[model samples]
Target: MSNTIVANDLRKRYGDVNAVDGVSLTVEAGEFFGILGPNGAGKTTTLEIIEGLRQADAGEISVFGQSPWPRNPALLPRMGVQLQASAFFERLTAREQLRTFGSLYGVPGRKADEMLEVVGLSDKADTQVEKLSGGQAQRLSIACALVHEPELVFLDEPTAALDPQARRNLWDVLRAINTDGRTVVLTTHYMDEAEVLCDRVAIMDHGRILRSGAPAALVRGLEAAARVSVASGVMNADEARTLPGADEVTDDEVSLTISTRDAPKVVAALAERGALEGVQIKGATLEDVFLDLTGREYRA
Candidate 1:
């Protein structure tokens, strides 16, 4: 696939710290990419610089093989951005807000209405922006961003504080957007969201990208194996560690967590010992991989 974005040694500095230091990555066309990091990490800074909202202190960036440095006006038309907190005129209705935004690109009213339906906001097309729910408002923000039908779209913390159902609804909308062949670059602290929505992800911390790949691939690269946990009914935790492929066993009052390279062997042994009642065989997750690479847990 052709590369849509290529950033090389991108750096940004604040008073005494480098918010983004020597970051480099490439995003392919039609790919759903995600950037994952904690607060104060360089993820947001890197994203903003790529979006051309902030100038880099050093290095180069290109979107669709053209320079985005210094915030190109022509580039703006071919890319859409939905900031963390999208603002809208309270008095304007959803349809009016989209129309106003579309006018910036010389797009007509019909385009705005079509976008509202695309984001499932058509039912409330006449509702004032201030009266819309949080999810509705965010959907409208996304609709406005797509007024020009850009090829590349950037979404920053797309589901920051919405309820479970609202978040799921937005995920569906984003998936639909991607299905139409638009490249989506997402930044979110929610690991589950990235695991579900992104085809590939880059984990960043302390102004650098620690790792980048498919979510499942990154997790599979961890040295830690799947966990085979069961209630410590009759088998001693230490004895259970002697099972084939079992590396370590952590025991509590009622349960034992077996870290095993071969879960089948450990589970069968536990079952033979009549200790499989409360067993749970769980696999590694993106959070686990991130914690292993960064030496820290990802906190929202």
Candidate 2:
């Protein structure tokens, strides 16, 4: 597949801090790519530069094989961006808001209305923007970004304020469009979201990318411990610790958990002892890999 985006040695600074330091990555056509980082990790800065909303102080960026800097008009119709916080024209109904956005690209009013349905907002079409709930507003922002049907879409923290069910619904909307061949790039705080939707992901911290790869591959590369658990009454902490390869064992009233490098040995031992009730084996996950790389400390 052809590259939809290629950024090389991108750099940016604000006063004394390096917001984006020597970052470079690529996204292929029709791929669902994710950028993950904690607060103050410079993910927003990097995305803005690539989206043509801001220019990098150093290095190069190309979207659709054209420079994104200088606000290239040629690339406008082919790209769409939904920022983390979206602003809408006051007093405009949801339908009118989408219509105005589509009109900017010379898209027909009918096409804009169709996008509202695509995003499951047809019922709220006549509701004013200020009256919509947080999740509804988020979906409207996404629909506006997609109204013109751009080939490349950028969504920053699209589901940040959504509840569980709403977030999953939005995921289905994006997933369907991506399957239809649009390239999507997203930045999000939720590790599970990235793991489920992104084909590949880049973990960023301290203004630079620490690792980039497919989620499954990155998790495998971590080589972290697997956790095995069973009902608490099935095995006491002391008995579980006696299992070969058990590194640590903890027992609460509800469950008994064993952390081990050799999950097979631990599992076999549990089976042999007839202590496999409610058995659950969980290997290293994307969240584990993320925490291992960026650390467990809180970030502002």
Write candidate 1's Cα lDDT for 1-300 as tens digits: 999999999999998998998999999999999999888788888989999899999999999888887778879999999999898976999999999999999898897789998999988999999999998988998998888899999999988989899999999999998999999999998999999999999999889999999999998888568888777766787788788878888888677888988889888887777878788999899989877877765456
Which candidate has the top score in TM-score? Answer: 2
* TM-scores of the models, in the order given: 0.91, 0.99
**Candidate 2 local accuracy as lDDT?**
0.95
* Clash list (residue pairs), candidate 2: none
List where candidate 1 sits over 4 angstroms from the true fold. Answer: 231-244, 247-256, 297-300
Error of 1 at 199 (Å): 1.4
Candidates' lDDT values, in order?
Answer: 0.90, 0.95
Clash pairs, candidate 1, are none
Residue 78 local lDDT, model 2: 95
lDDT of 1 at 12: 96
Off by over 4 Å in 2: none
